[model samples]
Target: MATYKLDCNGGSGNSYKLALYLNCAGLDWQPIGVDFAGGQTRDPDWRAGTNTMGEVPVLEVNGQRMSQSGAILIWLAETTGKFAPAGTVERFEALRWILFDNHKFTNNYAMHRFQVSLTAEPVHPAILSFLRSRAEASCAIVDKHLMDRPFVLGERPTIVDFSMAGYMYYPAEETGFDIETDFPALHAWRQRLAGLPGWKPPYELMPVGSSPPVRVVTQTA
Candidate 1:
């Protein structure tokens, strides 16, 4: 058995976050595909047995399950000491970014994407507009912050980068955001991240659909 097993839905950006970290860290991990579209995750038995929160990207180590990408990323950082913040100040900074990501960045962005591209049912325009506005505001904040830095913590990548990068790899059509033009600085930072060793686009790292993997074109060019 792999040292760690990740229960993931290929369509979930949250799942991509943990998978990215594991791959980049060179951890001995396996991706256990979850049939989220089939309503498996929401099944009572699955929720009680896997995650009461009813979420994917549940990390299992020695049969002990851990959910929530930010918490799992922190644990992995502390355990591997690979992408951990270097100092107390950096640690707090990392935490700040991580919280912002979960609350504003990935949260709104992922919701907007699902409504716009993934959902089989039509989403109300008012709802999509609300999510889009929130996502754009969050992207603007991070873009401005990253204007002068190579990574979230300044010169180096941290777990915060991994957290924020969750949905950035998906196609612009799916995300409904032209990050390259709308958030130039953020686009550059994403390229820097993609340049890291062992980096792979989300679909390539998980079992998603029969559709071929969309080539990730970093907006740097």
Candidate 2:
């Protein structure tokens, strides 16, 4: 059996995507909590040892360190012999959508959510409008791609679906984008993905003044 170490912040969508995939794959791995609220990801130890960029969902598999949620998802899927198609063309297609999600959808949504919605300081009107517009355009592209397929790869779920789902869902909730209202196919895809075995939401966003959320610890034997 291969042992893996996953360093992550519990509430982050990217972290949840990896967590869900690991669970679904029935892999033996350890989940090391990084407290984003306390800037634990920026800690020297985590940055040097796990991710130089200090990003969450960094996976250490058989002593090889890996970062980036989409890359990790592809690695896990290929390693576990699940969630990826067999043919070369099919696999390439899956990879293309995965890249699109990371480069296109996630980028725009992050700018809107973090820079505009979640910040303490006021955002400039021009910048806010630009981010929102970019986010909407990205979602429209996703909506079009998902129109005929239940998953990004095809009829069945794949690493691309798992990798993109969390990022897609984040904007829907944080930005009040209403994906279900605007894109029925994509909305149904979300519902289908959520119904999969071992599916779980990342973590509930805590209300103001609430106690800190409980962290889950995983041990690899």
Candidate 3:
């Protein structure tokens, strides 16, 4: 058995992706909660060891530390030999979507949600609109691909599903869009992920009610 440590904050899709992967793979790991509200990620000990960048979802394995959600996912998949495709092209495809989610989808949607829910002041209309459009467009691309298959890789779930599921776990109401309606295949895929053995939400990363409620929105096609 390998010992793994995860430093995480609940409600972050990035963190949830790691958690979901660990559970689905039946890997034993310890989770360390970081208080985002109190800026605990910036603490001296955390800065020196687990995460110098002061970001959540850092992973410590066999005395080595790693950060960044996508990087962690890829490392875990490769180390465990689970969910990762064996073929070179398929593996490259998985990595492509993982990067797409990080740079294209999450950057826009997560920022918009964070600003609207966590910030004290109103968000700028221009920025909000731009982010919302980006999110919608990203979803549309996913929808087109998902329309033909149950999973991004077809027939089997891979690390790409794990990566994408993290972002999709949030209700569309929070992002100001309906996911199921926008991407029915994605909605079904989420249900499939939930059915996996040992599946757990990002809530394990929090101390209890430390995060906001996930707003629910009906999917519209």
Candidate 2 C-alpha lDDT tens digits along 1-221: 44977777545667767777776666776577677767767789968877899777788877798998988887777778878666899888878887887787877776666654455565677887788788888888887888887888778888878887765555444554677887677788888888887776665321111112332212100
Q: Tell me the lDDT of candidate 2.
A: 0.70
- Model 2 TM: 0.84
Tell me model 3's lDDT, rounded to 2 decimals. 0.74
List the lowest-lDDT window of 10 residues for candidate 3.
212-221
Lowest summed lDDT over 10 consecutive residues: which window, candidate 1?
A: 212-221
Structure candidate 1, residue pairs in collision: none
Model 3 bad stretches (over 4 Å): 204-221
Predicted structure 1, TM vs. truth? 0.92
Instruction: Report every candidate's CA lDDT.
Output: 0.86, 0.70, 0.74
Clashing pairs in 2: none
Better of 2 and 3 by TM-score: 3
